[model samples]
Target: MSQPSPQPDRAAGHNPRSSGPGRLIIALYAVFVVGSLSRAGFQIATRFQEAPLAYTLSALAGVIYVVAAISLALPGPRAWWVSLAAISTELVGVLAVGLWSTLDPAAFPDATVWSGFGRGYLYIPLVLPVVGLWWLWSTRPGTVQD
Candidate 1:
């Protein structure tokens, strides 16, 4: 009697995308989302009048981080696109805010998430997006060899 053929192994099992270092990246992004969203919400609700621009930027950063975390957790072309968009936005925000604050410190009398290149957040804001892009590129479909 012929034996039944074994089932094909799923790519998910060894998907280097969300395994190993990728998992740590996702966790870090998630933590940032929580912290940023909470801080932004509190600042906007209670002290938006104090610094509208700073509060708005904080809100935007929180949203970008949320998107980044979600996209990193999922595996697909759409997720990859979302990750790229979010990370790109993050990089832009950090650079723009960093430059604007440096040139005219008075513009940001109050600190935003991207202020001083995330000096308030240990500069993770500056480095996280670059690392995120690297993760996405390394884990592109069929790019990770067994």
Candidate 2:
């Protein structure tokens, strides 16, 4: 006499990461996608000879941002795993590049998105992955009790 109920996950507090603050994280990722890609595009196009390594690294960071954003927005266990990988990579990238750039400034005359621990962008790129990883782990499937 009545229609079927919604999915159990929805009825419970097992919300999707794409919802709530997760959306904010995704939005931040989108911003990084634009910033990193545009910067890389401009550098690679107009000043490739000036700083090829930095520009290329920026482009790579942009691609990683794109992947992380999409994976976070997607809904599924597979997507969660992908988001995990992408965010982990981003973290490692920021840390490694931060140290490398700090140690060898000459190697990077310019700056990638991950350089200086994202100091150019107020270090958001450095902290974003940590937040994302925390969000994912906390909101992981079946973890929400309420």
Compute the lDDT for candidate 2. 0.90
Candidate 1 total steric clashes: 0
Listed in order, each prediction's TM-score against the native is 0.88, 0.89
Which model scores highest in lDDT?
Answer: 2
Cα RMSD for candidate 1?
3.3
lDDT by residue for model 2 (1-146), tens: 99987655654334488888999999999999999999899999998999999999999999999999998888777778999999999999999999999999999999899889999999998899999999999878667543
Q: Model 2 — which ten-residue stretch has the worst lDDT?
A: 6-15
How does candidate 1 fare on TM-score?
Answer: 0.88
Error of 2 at 118 (Å): 0.6
Deviating ranges (above 4 Å) for candidate 2: 1-15
TM-score computed on alpha carbons, candidate 2: 0.89
